[model samples]
Target: MSEFTSMAFGSAWGVKDWDESSIAPIIAREVQNSWRVRGMGDFAVGARECGSATGMLEKWKVLREDEIQKLEDVKWIGYVGVRDATTTSMAVGDTSQPTTRPWQQMIELRYGFHPEVWGKGFGTEAAKAIMGWCGKYIGAERFIAEIEIENLGSGRVLSKMGFEEIEKEKEVIWGMEGTKEWKIWVGR
Candidate 1:
């Protein structure tokens, strides 16, 4: 994990690999709040059945944060990172699908930023840094992201980072109507 912690930085921000340090609780709270702010929706209903903040925090044990103390240009916005998809039941992708590559080679990317930084390019910047770090240190060859179809801002960020729409699925989101989920994929 120390290898993953040595994350690269962009001009405006950097990513610290998710860890159980004092920063973990902060990252957990932000990760929870950012989901709704980033357009995933409220978890008032079916929180556990659907992908609630509590559920996600437990599912995505591997996360990363862009600590403001580590940056000089912007306030602490949120997190952007990847996790081993083969090992975890991904929120979107069909984990049952088989891949010839090793489990470590395929990863799922997730990100969230404060509303203030929504229109800014920080998501792309932080995403690029994390992807670069994973590719170099984790030997990750494939990256994927599961986003709500309505989250065009995040789609734009993924597009900017060279991700392509690999698939889409319709599902019931907690406390919301059926929503379309877009699973984007890219190769390093």
Candidate 2:
């Protein structure tokens, strides 16, 4: 075996280190611009401060310390961008100003992609890669994912990955962004 790495594969995808070169911040802006995170959840969760580029910039500042701490704690898996890059869809017209947030709970599996890539199976592919990594290296017998009850796309992905609902409750999920009133899914 070539030296082992924490990153792995899912179906047709592979993981890439989401460091300085990552398009994460730009994609995050896309999500915000698309109103993907607006008015979500039945309960208020997070500070609701990530609805604008300005807000995201503030969040980017708050996440730096957490990112360092998470990696040090080994609770973080780091952001892994799927190895597919196409700049044709940047509605922002310029990606040079994109920002990568150090704020994702690295221990938790987080993902983001431009809306143009939605429904193309990339989300599922990357999620599976991260989930598989968690199972193999985390030394834990169980894993969980928080999905908004109305987030059918994510729910379907988790279900396809063999996760089942062990319980249902409204809760807060603190990620690079905040989501509230989420349905929890666990792997058996």
Candidate 3:
């Protein structure tokens, strides 16, 4: 359990241990946001088309098991919820969900935080702990991320993690479809 508190909010936030039970909220949040689900790289056209994409529940069931057994998979997945330092409740503006590239590859990272917690440093803290765990346990030597052109906030978090853009590579983001290219970042 990495203790990640927000200096900006004067409140505590940390990456709670990964658990099989955490799947529900992660799934619930994914279902709640169509855009977030699309970024998952699972559905057709390389992104989720709708909230009701076929086999989502089934897919998530497998994902839950995968998270539990991430080390055996090609890409390692870790999940944690930001919680109130005092109460340990999920209700208190604990809205960041970190996304990563497929476990088969370089273990890229992405994150989304509730708007309320933006700028309070929660995202960066969660990201550091997530990346740290990946580096230490999974032997991930590099962290790659592709941010949408408009997602500057996510870009900032990548920067905070010491990830820098690969301006000239022209490499397409894996699984993302059709000409809507995203910018790439790499952290060593």
Candidate 4:
């Protein structure tokens, strides 16, 4: 865990192994923000079902079990992250690509942080660290993201990290229909 943490931590924040105690704060923060739920739908594992701590923990355990599934089914390889007043989660996983590009491995990257830390650069820091780990451990060659059009903050973070916009389309975000901007971050 220390080796992994060293790879994802910086001066202000760092990724930590999942702790059940931390789930409460995350759940408390998330259930109150529909945008957070919608923005993080794909990578959150159980955003819709996370209205309660027990439910969220149950879903997380299932995700942990499913973590061992075939690569194609892998939707989240993530870490729980903490900074002074911030709690975040980061994930990278194999995402579905167009049938026309069956051979292209589109690894998707995403992060969710408590609103208290919004605009504080924790998102960028955590994303940088998680991406660093994914590059080293998963050997991901390319990464993609589907962000809500309203989430300019996340888009800005991606821009800072070199993710370029590729497409825009309407999609279900956290069980609600909305426009999503797709972007890709390529490894150099």
Candidate 5:
């Protein structure tokens, strides 16, 4: 893992380091309530269908280990996290998968924060900071976020960061819960 620094958020917010043990529970909880929110609940439901974090992590670990081996050759992506100065909670971005064209990379903004933090502009702040990290740290030229069509909040967040809608598609990966795809290009 690489070193993470604190980011400014009107107050002070630092980025936390993500390890398997520390991130597991956070992902589990996030999956549990993902569908309860208006535009996000369906995602949660899809997670449920896929067996939640337990199943997802099993696959994720393998991919991460392989990606780590090739990190030197692969481009640096971005970091995902929440901050409050005293304590920072966040996840690192993963770009190992080939979700788009050969040159295009994907960054999964996994396990952001408690729903209570929603509508507080924290999402926007964190996203912008992460994008900056992608540019400075990961050297990423572009990134993609696949969100459910109904996920208006996330759509708004992406828009706030200057992510424009490039395309929409139906996906059946999350327990067959159809997904709306959105591609966000960040960086040059």
Candidate 6:
């Protein structure tokens, strides 16, 4: 976990171990927001969508003690949260459904910051730090992110991080029709 210490806000974020109680709320929040914005039915729908898309249904479907343990046990996976130093608001990133493809690891980088912190470079900094961690500690040869095509802000973030647009497809998993998703990849 010391590898995560050098990340932006990593020292202040704090935590070496995760349990169901600690991780559920974060997963719940991400699911709730994903459902609301993408019009997915709810957390369950979000879970199913992630399962179908990435096959790591167990990780995104629900929060449980075993899931936390599973995540902790993955030598190639890393998860982290970003927090405001003064306000204590947090954002999550690090894991998504495992990619169905064998050559690449499918991951989602989700970020949530207080409105006050928006437009700052904090998210980008945190993202870059995470990417570095992935490359150094996780031995990740490549990473993938799926974002709504309309999400220009997120697109900018990915572009700044050197993720290239690889493909786009219509996805109906989140109870939304004609949802265009951009599949971006980071690595050689």
Score every model by TM-score: 0.50, 0.35, 0.40, 0.43, 0.42, 0.41
| Model 6 per-residue lDDT at 86 | 14
Residue-pair clashes per prediction, in order, are: 0, 3, 4, 0, 3, 0
Top-TM-score candidate index: 1
> In order, what is each prediction's RMSD in angstroms?
16.0, 18.8, 18.2, 16.7, 18.6, 17.7
Q: Write the per-residue lDDT of candidate 1 for residues 93-157, one digit (tens) a residue.
A: 44454444454545667676655446656677667777777667666666766565456677788
Residue 178's lDDT within candidate 1 is: 27
| TM-score-sorted candidate list, best first | 1, 4, 5, 6, 3, 2
Estimate every model's Cα lDDT from 0 to 1: 0.49, 0.36, 0.41, 0.45, 0.40, 0.42
Tell me the deviation in Å of residue 84 in model 6. Answer: 26
Q: What value of lDDT does candidate 5 attain over all alpha carbons? A: 0.40
Runs of candidate 2 with Cα error greater than 4 angstroms are: 1-107, 169-188
Candidate 1 displacement at residue 151 in angstroms: 0.5
Better of 3 and 4 by lDDT: 4
lDDT of 5 by residue, 34-61 (tens): 4232112111101111234454212221
Residues 121-162, candidate 6, lDDT per residue (tens digit)?
545665665556555654545554434454555567668877
Error of 3 at 42 (Å): 15
TM-score of 6: 0.41
lDDT score of residue 75 within candidate 1: 32
Worst 10 contiguous positions by lDDT, candidate 6: 82-91
Ranking by lDDT: 1, 4, 6, 3, 5, 2
* lDDT string, candidate 2, 30-95, tens digits: 555433322111111112233455642233212332444233322121233211111211113354
